[model samples]
Target chain A: MSKQEQLQQLLGELKAALPELKEIIVASSDGLPVAQLGESEIATRLAAMAATAHGLGKRIATTTHLGNLVEIVIRGDQAYFIAYAIGDKGILGLTTPAGSNLGLVRLEAQEYARKLAGIL
Target chain B: MEPLKIVITGPVGAGKSTLIRTLSETEVVDTDAIATEAIGKPTTTVALDHGTLRLDGHLLHLFGTPGQERFDFMWEILAEGALGILLMVRADRPETLPVARNILDFIKSRAPVPYVVGVTHLDQPKVWQPEEVALFLGTPLEHTQGLDPRRPEEAVRPLVRLLELIGTNA
Candidate 1:
């Protein structure tokens, strides 16, 4: 499959796995939007925010000798934003309702992130 | 004139963010995270900064890019359709001049827009004057000005001159 199709399929699988998955975005490490299953504008903003969150998380982890960053989660009043590191070169941004199944979301995210990272 | 987008760029500690913070009429939107390295400063800009001002009956949008090369991927993205470039350089730190020139070259090689050099930190003792900076950057003396970036009045001086230069300097 083409790279774009592969990314769309990856996001689609994640959405299918979790009925509560509100949005999913895959972006390069440099904040370029690769593929997204959300509004175009949010994808652009998500690309930058996810990259920054991943960089900050990685920096903090490396500094504190915590190994490497796996996930960075920001829980707000109404929603939860997750920035998951895709190996060392990309970020996967996901959002969901505040009380959604965090465990299942992370599980599905981890699997798809690895696959997406390899394809990227 | 319609809304004009101007790119603000320089090396680390060269006052690119400070200039925007001081001159922007609205609250500047910035994406500065903790520095991963020892750069004398605790935080560094990762994504572009956003600010706007109305000058000479025209809205001027200021976009500031990070100085670190690791974040250099943002340079082109933030520079899209920029009418002019305002290259800020720290007069106190001579080491940053080359990187400042590289940023200029990178953007100019792509857009070839008119630009003016803003030599900052002039209030500090023993710094390069505008003429010498103009000589070093290889731009004409008229296209360079020294200012204290901490002051909004002084910070906007070079940009006003840049807008004027776009009429002739480009």
Candidate 2:
């Protein structure tokens, strides 16, 4: 399968696993959208912002001697926006409804990020 | 020492980050990532590039905004309370002039600060002159000049001019 197809399939599986996820975006390290599910209109902007967050997170990690960056989570009053680094060249961003299972979401997202990294 | 905030903005590959790095006295904080598109550069700034320098005994905090439009929201954030702006445009790439103009308009609409346009890549062949760029950007010729961002002395011309426009000598 093509890389795009693989990415879509993985995103599909992730969505199925976490029905609470409002959105999923796969973006290149440079802020370009690779794949997205839900709200396609905001995908471009969200992907860019996700990459920016990932870049800033990596910098923060290095500056504070916090070892490798794992993820960046922005908890809003209504929802949660989480970004994970998929290897060095990609990022995985997800939005989940507030009150969702945070620990489970992180676990599943991290696993999907790893699979996405391999395809990227 | 008084702190003067100056914002450096331009399109991708216009040398915003390079200029800040060349002019900064302290270590620059940059958020550059590998570019997915072939924009003639390997990496692009996703967030902001921050640096500081002392100009005429005043501490200048320089913030370089990401060049892509998707990150344009940062322009207003960085331009907040900025005393002046230095907009960089690649002289060799006239096509980017419109985008540069849009960026200038967006920031000036919010901050209404003094600005100077730095026309980089003058050393390259088939490049636009500062006057032509100024005309296209609707900025005064005096506020636009060609400079090499990689060179310390040349890289600082626009900032100094911006400072002068802001009624401060650098």
Q: Which candidate's DockQ is highest?
A: 2
Writing each residue's lDDT as its tens digit, candidate 1 over A1-120 gives 998998899899888888688779997765657889977777877776777667656656775789967799999999999988776567889999988988888888989998998887
| Candidate 2 CAPRI assessment class | high
Candidate 1 lDDT over B1-170, as tens digits, reads 68889999988778888999999998787766555356778777777777898887878999998886645557878778998999999888878788989988988877678898898887778888889889999999987988888888899988888788676654
Q: Estimate the lDDT of model 1.
A: 0.82
> How many clashes in candidate 1?
0
Residue range with the least summed lDDT across 10 consecutive positions in model 1 chain A: A54-63
Best by lDDT: 2
**Residues B1-170, model 2: lDDT tens digits:** 88999999999999999999999999899998988888999899998999998887678999999998988878878989988999999999999999999999999999888999999999899989999999999899999989999999998888778878888533
Q: What is candidate 2's TM-score for chain B alone?
A: 0.96
- Model 2 pairs in collision: none
For candidate 1, the TM-score is 0.63
Model 2: residues >4 Å from true position, as ranges? Answer: B168-170
Give the Cα error of residue A101 in candidate 2, in Å: 1.0
| Residue-level lDDT for B95 in candidate 1 | 80
